[model samples]
Target chain A: MFSLLLQSFVCCRFLSSLWLSQHSVVCLLLQVLLTHITISNSQHNTPNPTMMKSIVARAYSPFCSVFATEDCDKLANDLGYEDLITLLAPHGDSVGRATVRDSQGMTNTYDDFAIRLGAKRPTERDSGGMLFNPDAMEALLREYIGHYNSDDSAFARFFAKLVAAPPDTAFETFSQPAAHLFCVSSRNAHPLDTLQALAQGQKRDKDCLNFYVLVHDARVEDAENSTQRTIALLERAKKRFGLAGMIKLGQEGVPETIPTPQFLTVGDELVNLKTGVGFGSRTLSQPDKESIRSLLREFTVQHLIPHMERCIMTWDTVAAGKRGLTGRMFSAGKKWLKFGGSEKQEAGSSIQASGIYPQGSPEQTIRRLADYAFMLRDYRYAYATYELVKRDFLSDKAWKYLAACQEQAAVALLMYTTRLTEKQRVEVLNPLLDSACYTYISRLQLPQYALRMLVVTSDLQCLLGPDAASQGATQWFQKLLDERLVGRLGYALIMLRVSYAFSQSPKGRKAALWQLLSAREWADANQKGEMAKCLDMTAPVYDELNWPNNEGTLLTRLKGELANEAKPTSVAS
Target chain B: MSYYLAIVGTEDNPIYTQEFGTYRQGGDGNSRFSPEMKELAPFILHAAIDMVEQTASRTNQLYLRTVDNFYSHLVSAFVTAGDIKIMLLHETRNEESIRQFFQEVHDLYVKTLLSPFYFVNQPITSPVFDQRIKSLAKKYL
Candidate 1:
């Protein structure tokens, strides 16, 4: 067959380069000849290439959940390397190349392709179910690479298969509809007030956050229930706020499932909420209020806009930002892809790459998937999706959006994901890299985001090392501390987080205690008795949240502060 | 314009300290610092070490000219091949003259290190070394 001639020519030319003993050279060359014959013979024996292509394409597409492996198969099966080039040309994304010089001063050329699947989000006026999923195309690329090759050939094929896919979104490949988020609770309930405050606070969003308050239906089973007073209080409160459509579980108007337990369903979080809503217009600590405001403002920007923009997205390469590789690159998906018109002569139309996707392909599906993840409280998935798009868009607005995503991702890591493996914790669950990116906020001239990032580092374990500080947490803390615009109590809270991040070991715990005491000092300096009183409450709450290895001294101090509320004096002094 | 010159060793400890004033515009070569300014001059110079350490890793320049500013005062630094640091805190803005003074000081430092009794990062207490730095300050400030 043709492979026999290929084996002979390749061996004769590469024989000297192989640098084998005289006897082994002939032996290796014969082995190569035999292997080629076996492979070519099997391929020739298989009938019907037409049925094979469809089967291969169907198996490689995003919808296919199963993977089949052949131990000794070639890396590029029915889909060779050149077929990938053809895939890009049809979509009109620019096919180009760039040559980079390594540290050794040698230049090597690379196929640099930049693509955007769902960048143009619909404006805020109209957000609907018709969303474009960005990961659909990335999933295709991963599938083609993962399925085509034998295990040993993977190392050789990985570079060619490299695609900035969002983490394996193939599981929910059929774009599902958004689930409604509604709350059910009784009136005069502290948790009800919090949900009401949250609903009123975020009304401007107008998209998503269906924040329904459902007072429990009264006179259950012919007046056997004495829960009538709580219902009446809630009903009066609801009428005062002009809220209609109160829902009860299994009632006609209510959603089958209630999301966000903090809003609905009475909980322990409400026990402390009797004092007040955490965020409001009347708070004297203006900085804490402003910090919370900034957090909410960013939340609206991320949650609302993407929800609306899902309708206007384009899968074609024409919609991609023509600009790439402009600023300090915080992530991948950028390169000087095209030099001039002469690029076609080099790669022949074969290995050419583009950011374009064919119109019917899954790549243009909903970016709303990320927004959905965030709203669903699946921060890990939200982090993955945001990282996918934010790398492509580093504009001032998008970068700030990325900052919000990072902060939320960090919060998700600390609150959840403790039970995962160390490798899983570091890679999928933790936002340590996002913390590194948080320092870039200063470059964007948003100091509030920098302050938020410092607070975020409280969740990062000390084992993550000093790079977390050098990246910007410590430097920004020093900068903000010196400037002192952040409130005294808020500053104390941030310091608490930073000190906690550094206190995974018992030896470091002593130093962390001094930091906690200093937070109380700052609270006292601000002259806010409520903040000073509430400062110690963090330890017991954090303990209940199952955060690891907290110092016992912090709890004792908090309990003492709560017990001494009548006198309000320093426990030791 | 005034100058506060310091020679910092590899361990970030100060090996030398001297104060000088503008010799240009018919000014006398004496420090015009108030009692408070004289004390704060050292603090300003030390605060700039972080800035020096930051900028040093970015470039190979021997004279890291005017890397940090504290209020009205500006700080400049020079890093030697021996990893020693020479810092200058002043109100002046002439980079060329400062570079010239740094090159001369670097030569003098080389000559001082040639002595057998001296150890690296040891306090540079020789009166002759002090006199040479003062002359450079007169020529540059």
Candidate 2:
């Protein structure tokens, strides 16, 4: 989900190779699934499990749902508010900087900071607290994306929903938006009225940032006219909605009005959804690009960052106040164990029998705080906060929450720590990933999540450098194979990667053997090009080696298969 | 118990291969592998050779127990001197007895190697060697 140009140095280096390799597979699978999409409008039905898996995997980015009043929504119907943000975010030359106070009360700055935006269409108003249903929401999204399955019978539909949704509580918690962008289009006649109604209607909450953007169209009106209109709207907004009061409370910030020449540009493909709605893409001039970038930079710097900083402070204080002195001491003691502690000894913090951490409870607050810190790119603080909540989730026997915390904790460490020392790798990252992977795969039976976790962790490990790191990576790749988590193409791709990981390590013969295995898998998958490439890669090691006759025959037959592939395509036997 | 045993030479060449069944606990000794499993067994064992070599390098022990598994079938291995591996693909795990069986096979393998007519990496065609292995499976596996 990361924009290649805007990603942090560490993230770019860590993700580039893995992302490149996975890009083809993910796209190919999506293409295959999209072809199967049936756009029938039948009665309510549960999503297909495999279809849900693919959809869930695609929605891994941090979501920021865009909201607007009816008039603004109608005005920008061609280019939805969310789609506008998505299109502009990647094309910008720079999004500038943000300096925020982390959970540990340390200030950190990120240059060229950007959010990996997803086009999360606005839904009904979130009932103002922690009980957002990610499955229902994602199901809605799946429907929007044309993955709705109408063939499922009513009872089967009910049972499928019952089985699939509840166990994946981690994903539910993650689907909580980092921020919500409310828009008041310049085209709307009563912009001030719409803004006031949206501001008042949106329940003022401390959990997520709710910032406003005045979407101006330069093609309709000049920038000076729109800016004058925006100022007038803000003046009226201050008096009507008491925006100045919200700004003082750190709950809101100054509104931004951004202009675009046109939503659609030349040579852009029109995206047709299941609803038969088509959204246009735009080409931007340099000034338009700069204004869009400036808008984001201003929003992130002035509103989102400050909002998160204030919330972290608020949540930390609330959690600390609830915890009291002895609880603080107990948490400090627990922190000692967090560094190098074994899994068995982490059962110290106990929760009551009810098992639910209420919306504003210290545990829930800290969890939200962690999520915010992660979204804000304050990884160190996020890591610490996640580690803190993990114990509470563990003691409460909340497998989904615990697994999500562990997964985030590992990711935070990878992102924040400049260099991953062997000690940290063994003590911290390994156990976190292992426990998370176990919970996701075994307890939740969410192999898709487990696959994602291992793939990301292994790639991060490989990026940390060769030797022990690459060896660790190879081991994780082997786990993917052992678990049989991927399809045939995925299996072949993983084998090819494992070979590369081995080659990165000092194990030459093992590397060559893995190349051979990869070639064989590719052949099985009927990917003759990849099969030929893998065979060629292993040739240096196996071609003239004094090995047995069988290996020799394997190479010969693989070459024969490639030769046959050239003659005419036959089914892989 | 169904078993597929292969002795792999240093260069990953199979020197000897056999498929047999347990003659213990009122059971007759007859290989019970399904047709698909029989065809897949070679690939499984061959794949485990990578694990065997990797594990063999890490430990000084002759018996590298249960190096890898595919489905319900477990691949237990024993490494002899000169990097040759004795691998057994079987269902269910009886670790101590498997170790004892492997040690006995190691003895037979060594004895076979000591014979003047035999050489390393050559397929074992001796009827006597096959008879001894079946008897060993009957006693221990």
Candidate 3:
């Protein structure tokens, strides 16, 4: 019986070992299959149409994807690879195609899928999720680049948007060939890289690779490339990528270089390149001219206006002496003057006459008509003028003027809220806001404006409340504040004002507490007397609430007590 | 045709006034208002100011109709958004002629408005404005 049991045990051990081997093999095969499935699925799936549409809308073009070999085979079979090649080939060039093909072959693998599986995926990046979802990328590429002709301004704008940042991961997934092509052709190595580069440079470049290189050089003194090498690269980018505008090649040789006044001075050369005449005619038909102008207008109407308005509002509180119509008119007038051209003569003439040099000359007139229009309390004329100026400035590539115009446009839109339809609000306000945020975060020479814009954005977010959509904006502002682009004091004041306006019901007090705390902290800093005064004005409201005796409570009490003693009630009796 | 024009200030005070005639083809360059019309010129001009205000309020633009007529004389007004009105009363053949006449007057009004010496809704008493208006009438009429 013992011998029989030992034999049975040995048999059981042998069977168990064999079963373990089989199970291991199956698991390995399953892993392989899963990776292959993911690769194939990614290859088959395309980019999100909405994202692609946004890219297209921004770029103003249909963008083709560079498909991986397997995906290419599938797409080729379905859409004809030769036709696809022909479609994207011209943009690629023979050298570009060869380089792209070589790069694709070098990088091609199912390893990316395996790696993706290994890591926890980010739920979303910015407004969307999964930077590179192959199917979504493909679909997006098709939608973005499909119907539109290459030369369309829409295509240019879309391309500009894509090249403005890094090539997205969706861009990477959908078309390896196209991705490779963009990598070689544009300055940005990738989308995230582009965003990082843009963040560093404080400006967007439509030429991806070249912009990346230029900005890299601008930011990092110890970067591998020499100044001459950087300049050569920029020249190559200028020639090969058709890069427009002024590119700084020389070195002050510092990592994280603050842009010099010379950068703004470069506007003249850019303007000349755009208009072909130095401040001669108000319009230009050249594509680069138009693109630059549109960009400027977008920047100004969206970014600069809000800053100026905030500046005005801040001035209203701080510099109350300058709050008259003439001063307001003067500030707005300066913006219009920058754009060139006259509306009503007094509008322009008065500006000129004020001894405040218009954009071109000290003697030139800055019109008051635009100011009147902007301040008319009816926004139709203001909106129209803003649109016109935006279009004209964008076409002209008048960078300074464009920036100013976009800033003004934002303020006008915000102030004239009743005039905009829902669709118009979304269409106009979103771009304006985006542009403003972009400019401010980019840190282009309007620091005060940037600070003011952060306030506006914060206000808008508060107004919108805490929705999933707004959460992104809230995060954006948080990030902005975190970066110290906006000082705590400024951010707190704007937040206080926005919260006060948005808080309607009883919950408003709760909502206002955070702002009140921020305001109290700002008041404590107490550098600016006027800001302190404004804080003093708001303290009574917090005091009336009579909450816990924290720092917020103490500050409120002190301020409220002081205010009460300052004013005595007048009785008719 | 004789012309009587007045620029009224913000306070409805007369800032400037000019009287002239068509210095064009076969027309004498003389004021041709009837004695009574001439006597009533300021009142006529003042009345036109009321019409301008009413028209501007309604339309948000400042083109008033022929507000007053005195013995074949027609007074037409063009007011700017700033409440500055250019009132032109002319003795002309018909509506079409008067319309052409006013069109010229409008151009002169814009040119005058462009002048730094003039403020919106203020009396335009500048000699240069008067000379320009006289020249515009001669050239267009």
Best by the TM-score measure? 2
Report lDDT (CA) for all predictions.
0.42, 0.60, 0.39
**Clash-forming residue pairs, model 1:** A115-A355, A121-A309, A122-A309, A131-A366, A132-A364, A132-A365, A132-A366, A133-A365, A133-A366, A187-A234
Q: A1-573, model 3: which lDDT tens digit per residue?
A: 234445555655576677656566556555655664444222211222233222211221112222122222332233222322222222211111000011012322111010000011222211222212223322333333333332332222222222221222210111111111121212334433432333344323221122121322133455456445545655655564443222222223322211111111122223433443322222212432333234323322333323334322332232222235775567466556665354323333223322222332211101122232342222344444555445433433333334445655664555434233446546776576567556544634444444444444333333333341133234445545555653344444334333333232222222233344444544454423323443443333333332222332344454564455445633322
Of candidates 3 and 2, the better by DockQ: 2
TM-score for candidate 1, please give it. 0.35
Candidate 2 residues lying further than 4 Å off, grouped into runs, are A1-63, A69-112, A116-173, A220-282, A321-325, A328-357, A394-400, A410-505, A508-566, A569-573, B25-30, B34-59, B104-139
- Best candidate according to lDDT: 2
- Best first by DockQ, ranked: 2, 1, 3
Off by over 4 Å in 3: A1-372, A375-378, A419-425, A440-443, A453-488, A519-573, B1-141
Say which docking band candidate 1 falls in: incorrect
Evaluation by TM-score, superior candidate among 2 and 3: 2
lDDT of 1 by residue, A356-448 (tens): 222223222323444444433344544555555443333223333345445445544543333444565457534443453444444344444
The clash count of every prediction, one per candidate, is 10, 0, 69
Among all windows of 10 consecutive residues in model 2 chain B, the one with the lowest summed lDDT is B35-44
Candidate 3 positional error at A324, Å: 37
